[model samples]
Target chain A: LVDALTDRELTRISCGSAFREHFGAPYTVVHRRDLHGALLEACRKREEITLHTSKELASFGETAGRVLARFADGSEYEGAAMIGADGLRSRVREIIIGDGTPRPIGHVSYRGVVPLDQVKDRSHFDDMVIWIGPNLHFVQYRLRGGTVMNNVATVASERFERGERRDYGGPDELDEVFSHTTPHVREMLGYVGKDKNWVLHDREPRSGWTRGNVTLLGDAAHPTVQYLAQGACMAIEDAVVLSGKLKEAGGEINAALLAYEKERYLRTARVTITSRIFGDIIHCRGGARDLRNHLLAQRTPETFWEVDWLYRGIKA
Target chain B: LVDALTDRELTRISCGSAFREHFGAPYTVVHRRDLHGALLEACRKREEITLHTSKELASFGETAGRVLARFADGSEYEGAAMIGADGLRSRVREIIIGDGTPRPIGHVSYRGVVPLDQVKDRSHFDDMVIWIGPNLHFVQYRLRGGTVMNNVATVASERFERGERRDYGGPDELDEVFSHTTPHVREMLGYVGKDKNWVLHDREPRSGWTRGNVTLLGDAAHPTVQYLAQGACMAIEDAVVLSGKLKEAGGEINAALLAYEKERYLRTARVTITSRIFGDIIHCRGGARDLRNHLLAQRTPETFWEVDWLYRGIKA
Candidate 1:
């Protein structure tokens, strides 16, 4: 989606894992000395994605109804408006809404990415399969052109007491969630390493999805856990809806942005709530699981078959 | 699998809704008659699958193999071999592998069969999915041509010494296994009615898979908690291997039966042990779940993927 509606090219960055895993190749195998040049070239080609790097707004300036985002480098671009996809620690989110502290979700998610063929019995599973057991749940899905499969496992916890960020989410925490999963699942997780990732499940909807011509999308506007497999789906939806409103609203940046949030907030909020509802249903009380099973036995295929056409034909 | 081998054409007893669920609809509706008649007709089809229901063998009629069965109609069919697939309480198993009564593996399972549609979010799960959480574990699977899903939830219990059918399985006894499951799971019991199947996890491999022509199969031969979704799989595998061995010996029933037991005993024993390993992984100390997850992360897809394949591909 980023490839559309912009003249700016993209640059990708990582320790080669994401490159091989997500896009199946790295931007280049050049030395660190050439990284800046590589990034600039990537920006030219509109193909840059970064992790393990620092990003900050070098300058936030306003033009005729346009917000300018100047990075640390000399790169600057003109746009009708800037969209912030920055996440939970979103600087724009903090600057615009003034809510600096992130609320604890009382949940933690452990995530990994493995190749698709690595799994056993693909005949019964799907491109995206979820195992929602009692207090914890996990999702496995294909990505990177189906060359790799990603896994995200979460566990419900009432304990979100503050602790050192570095110390809190480590191997011990990831292990805790798997303890309740099956041995089959335990065997599945045998490959996660420090090279993997874990994230806390605590973020609120941004108070304002937009400021002037600048707006937020994806995790910045409405952060959510992967419970529903709707994170990327929402971001894509946001892009489409925003572009539609922007093109239709014409010259009024203010009206367009308001309309975008109005058109999107309640809908996204509903999804956010629904996602959480689904999570609770999967991880709720013991009897709830029973009722869920009974209802599934009684209701699933009928309900499940319709999902493909639901959400107004949104395809993931 | 059950339908392909059944005498469905002769017997047609639809289970109102009781015991039919755990077996699913395919096993229920696919089989033309009630379990009682189906068993009888099944026995007639190859005259091979005998209906031992209500048949009690009084003495061991020695034919190289001592028979442990007695017919209800006062008939005897002693052969060179015998088996005890009578379930958790097997007279054959008892006589052949004499020892103290079976001991619970510090766990007991809650079993229920409910209308498939009754389970809410049923589509969100698979016909077979295992949920593992600290101190709690449950498995859900669809049966009867995707009509109903059977559920078996397990939890550790030091004792069930209460005056609730210490020797007989009953609904009240079944309810306790679900005490810690989700509430939705508990509500499904509305369909549980008078017939409930909760059994202690008195699972141990048979010390002897054969006592001459008398060989055991299914739960009687080796009772297993549904930790790995391999119980029914093993039974089916048993039939295949036993039949193969019998065929290989050119209908020399004695040699074939012995080989069948020999081949199956080791395989079944290994599966049972792995499931117990899984049980320990899921239902052990709170700290253990964490350790299990950590161990999984350290493993690569190559490491666990082949192991899963080996498990699924194991024959006989």
Candidate 2:
């Protein structure tokens, strides 16, 4: 994987123990847009997968051994099994499991990329640095081959009302939430885009996802909170396992769907739940915050292998 | 009310300041089944109310300005508007809101009613005693006017598997969970019914509960965990408020339903979330547990009046 990237795109080397100790494995930092472009190009080359753009799902139903999907343009498509890989606000999911909406878990994040030279203090530009504090965290890392630095600052905002998604939160609120953090963290906050705040939302992991000839994948199935940074990784893993299960089932759609759900539900649920609990532990106040910092400060590369199961590819 | 009951059914009076100082309102101590029977009798006297038994709901739908409910026995009933007052496994709720099931919140309780004479200690029989401890709580109160002592002991069970409702927990497990409690609390636990234990389950407070001519009430709408003891109170309040809204709406079912939801959602949500948070606070461990106990012990009768809103009933 390291050999596939140019030297500039390779993960920058640094003496940041927080980065080196936590992720003992090789890491590369690429902008998510670039990663998506590469994967989309790879999909475009596959003759079996046809891409559809602007085809909004209106509703879906199953009948007479086929899954029928209707689009907003009044066109219909039939397939043996339909996979709902649509992101959050999924119409396929709404048709499958009616009416329940994703809930806001009272947190928001402001993210943007800045040219390295544009930043006044580029001290941590070569390293992934995460400053954890009470009810807030600031993460900065190099992206797009170190030419651009990506920053995500999240706060547990009481002002982020439940059931409402706001696209842009005021910069004053951002400053207030991060005012207590170190000067370096406050510096990273300056690079956040003017109107790019995302109010984070997630659904409680459902007990079941597959029903008959229709199933869900990726964010549609498990819209995990972004604390773990495993949302994309889990989705890619799901694609592999789901395809493998379908192939192994030999055209038995129901069996394949059941097998896929069984294989992935536990692992995905663990990841989602662990990530949420990790956020809770790191976002504690008073004594608990002290305990969390004391524990994190003691992390060493050998002892930080708890995430080996996550980094290592899924077992066959 | 006291004069209406026979001597054996009258509430036992004692010099306990806790009971007199806290409630400051009319109270009763009747077995739930008996109280339910009395309410049913009262409803039977009303010419407009009709009671249906053993009628399991199959499905329901609304059409032609009426809500049509189908029963498993092929019988059907249609009404201008329908209120789903069905309990936890409500079929009406399933028809209205699909696919989501109640989740177990990793707790279980053993409850039983023993004759007061059967117990060796009768020290606090006249008073409702609640013992809050780390990851466990014990509540005991008199019922049936002191003839029976109702004991409910709940434990935060690590052994309790998710999504599995165990009917009978082993005595050894029960003993292990309550082993750290005082001797008096342990004595109360000894009277737990041998073959009866309840697995507590609750859903996240849903944002909306009404659609068109149909709505939900009580546990069907918000199946709250029993920590707050407001489940029944909320349901009764729902009945009063829902009926008032319908009357005020002047035959407009949709408007009435929406009004009922608007009037009740915030209040019920506050109750449910507060109860869950109260449980979390009381169930803390180590330093947190000590803090909770300290706060609880220092609570005066006036201080406990924080729930005046709950007891005083919903405002018009």
Candidate 3:
């Protein structure tokens, strides 16, 4: 995957070099926006798909066994079923589920990419380095074909509760949070510009996604924190599995949607929960941190391949 | 309350006459549709309200500190806040909360009114009698100023699950369920026609409702089982308390909504849970049914008035 994503100068790092065969695919780097744009373009090329821009949902209901979606301008569209892929603050999810809000996990993340020219040294360009500590972690990865390095710093926020928004406090505050770290880590923080931080929100696993003729997909169905970087991947998987289920069900749209839900629910839930646990392990304090590091050092090729369950698809 | 509602011939009943002073307000009967229409007219008269029909939610979002509602026709309406009172399959509830379908408790109810003249005798014309048996219960009440008697028969169904529509099996199935019940009860069940049966669906208590600038009200927020008869009453109380809180919040819409939810959550949840318990107690079988009957027979006027928790409201 690393060779496929970018064949730029590779970083020989402590983690990847230590367990190259076990890792199966070397960690690849890609810009988030570029990946999103590529997916959008692929979707646009599909013959059956017509992408509508700036179209919003007024309300939705069922009439004569068809899903009737009414827009604000008094126009309506009818279909056998409707798939809600409306991201985290999903309106279609709201229509089917009623009201449940995403919970804040008291963590805020600052993300930005620094141009390679600005860095004093670029020797770590191929290394995806994760600096773990008490209630905080910093990850630096190559992006833009290794010309720029992406830096993400996650810290435990003090004031924000489960439902409250985080108040961003500029780059100086970012510097203060990582003051106890090594000098090189402190210098990495200097590269992050203001206006790049955001509060991370997620939800517990839910049993429901399909209701009658309406169903949910992607973040509208299950949204998780960015700890695993599998949010977009899971959504893409949902689209594929859902389409396959719809075709498999013959002509019953609701039944097909339900089948899709049954197939994808546990897999997505596992990803959501595993990502949380993975973050907790990396952001440990005191004795737990030593234990986590010890476990990482002890990773055999066989044990590391345990993540094959994640990289590979679930059993039929 | 009875005199205020209508000037019809009233039933002098055992329960009401037995504890006249303790009951507080005399029970009044009004057609559900008539009462709903009255409420609608009152809402229509309010100058602050504008009634829009056929407007459905296409999608919704938050922008510039406002809740943006987009209809299916591609038009948008922005508000400082939104209150979702869309009832049962509420579109607004779906937007604020994701998908959690209501659970069915395996019961179907057949309801209809029989004119007093249809019966050979009208001796129990004003009396409200509940005949309970194993897995079934029959309720007979006077309606339309004692000119008619309404019979409701609730029976357990084997075929349907929660979120599935109830199949109306006509009077023969109703007769089969109540064959072992009392002769009078069996005769009363004959009065209900084939078309009035409905499946009862409800949800367990949920935690999330208010999110940012949007919230839910009444059935859209907390939909309870009909066993309590408090569904409409609780919805009415929600409206009153929500408006009061909104006024009290001064200018903070989210705070007012949070306050309204806080005041109502526990009270409504209690009603929802208690109603389910009451239904279970009423629909007991074998030894449980005998025990329940014995307890009902032993009830004194004081014991009957013990429903002050329900009638007078829970202690503060």
Q: All models: lDDT?
A: 0.56, 0.71, 0.69
Higher-scoring candidate on TM-score, 2 or 3: 2
TM-score head-to-head 1 vs 3, winner = 3
Q: Write the per-residue lDDT of candidate 3 for residues A1-316, one digit (tens) a residue.
A: 1111112221223345645555545556579888988878988899977777666788998876599898767778888889989888888887787657787777778877888888764655667766766566777888877788888887765444233354643455556667767666667766666566777777766657888888999888888887778888888899889889888888888899999988887678767766876777666553344334434555543454546667665432
Q: Candidate 2 residues A1-316, lDDT tens each?
A: 0101111121223335654555554656667899899999999999998888899988888897699889999999999989988988777788777548887777778888888788887655466766676677777888877788787888776465332346334566677867876666677678787476777777766546788988889988878788778888888899899989989989798899889987887677667666776677656564344334434445553443556656665865
Which one wins on TM-score?
A: 2
Query: Residue by residue across B1-316, what tens digits does model 1's lDDT show?
Result: 0011111121122323532342333321222234446656766888456454566545454444445445657776755556566766767666666644665655556566778767775542443445555445655666666777676655555344332335433444345555654555555444444543455564555446566667778777766765655666677688788878877898466678778877776566656656766676665432233334434445442343423432444443
lDDT of 1 at A100: 63
Query: What is the per-residue lDDT of model 3 for residues B179-293, given as tens digits with 9 covering 90 to 100?
Result: 7765566667777776667767676665478987788888888888777678888888888888898888888888898988877776676676667777777775533443344
User: Which regions of candidate 2 are displaced past 4 Å?
Assistant: A1-152, A155-316, B1-24, B27-29, B161-170
**Clashes found in each candidate (C-alpha, N, C closer than 3 A):** 83, 0, 31
10 residues in a row with least lDDT, candidate 1 chain B:
B1-10
Q: Which residue pairs of candidate 2 clash?
A: none
Task: In angstroms, give how far residue A196 of model 1 lies from its true place.
Answer: 4.1
State the DockQ of every prediction: 0.02, 0.01, 0.01
